[model samples]
Target: KDTHDSLRDENVSIKKSYQDLSMTKASNSNVSSRAVVPEKPKVLAPGLYAMTPKYVPP
Candidate 1:
């Protein structure tokens, strides 16, 4: 039957993929995945300003 043939083909491909997954999974299971650690922002000091004379006569 056409339906049976397609089903068998799908099963064959599925089995192949399952085997690949199993092979790769063995190495991955030993070590965990790494993620970037969040860093805290540094605080900055404010700049100081000098006062100037408003009036000057020569």
Candidate 2:
């Protein structure tokens, strides 16, 4: 009985972990779409332009 209960508890925890991971992935996907993915700047003239990451923390 003890073993069965432990197994059930472990399964529940595993299921919750998976749910959290899925939620994180979904949120990241949404955030990624909302992010302004920067494109390579075309240098029309010789000038140094500061570059930044494509994704910025909201």
Candidate 3:
């Protein structure tokens, strides 16, 4: 009975720690999207349209 109780307690603690780890990962991703992600600008592929008249094929 004592072993079973101890095992259950350990299991609960491990589960709580795992939950915390996953939460931390989610928080990290949120922070990255909010801050670090914008630092690296997205390079949009060139389209057929141009912004100005001078944008012509060489």
**Model 3 lDDT at residue 14:** 100
lDDT of 3: 0.61
Give the C-alpha lDDT of model 1. Answer: 0.59
TM-score of every prediction relative to native: 0.49, 0.51, 0.51
lDDT: the better of candidates 1 and 2: 2
> What's the lDDT for residue 3 in model 2?
100
- Tens-digit lDDT string for candidate 2 (4-58): 9999999999999999999998777765554453467645567743444664445
Best by lDDT: 2
| Per-model RMSD to reference | 22.5, 7.0, 12.9
Clashing pairs in 1: none
Off by over 4 Å in 3: 31-58
lDDT of 3 by residue, 1-58 (tens): 9999999999999999999999988766654342222333454665323234323222
> For candidate 1, lDDT tens digit of each residue in 1-58?
9999999999999999999999998766546343222243232444422322322221
Show model 1 residue runs off by greater than 4 Å: 32-58
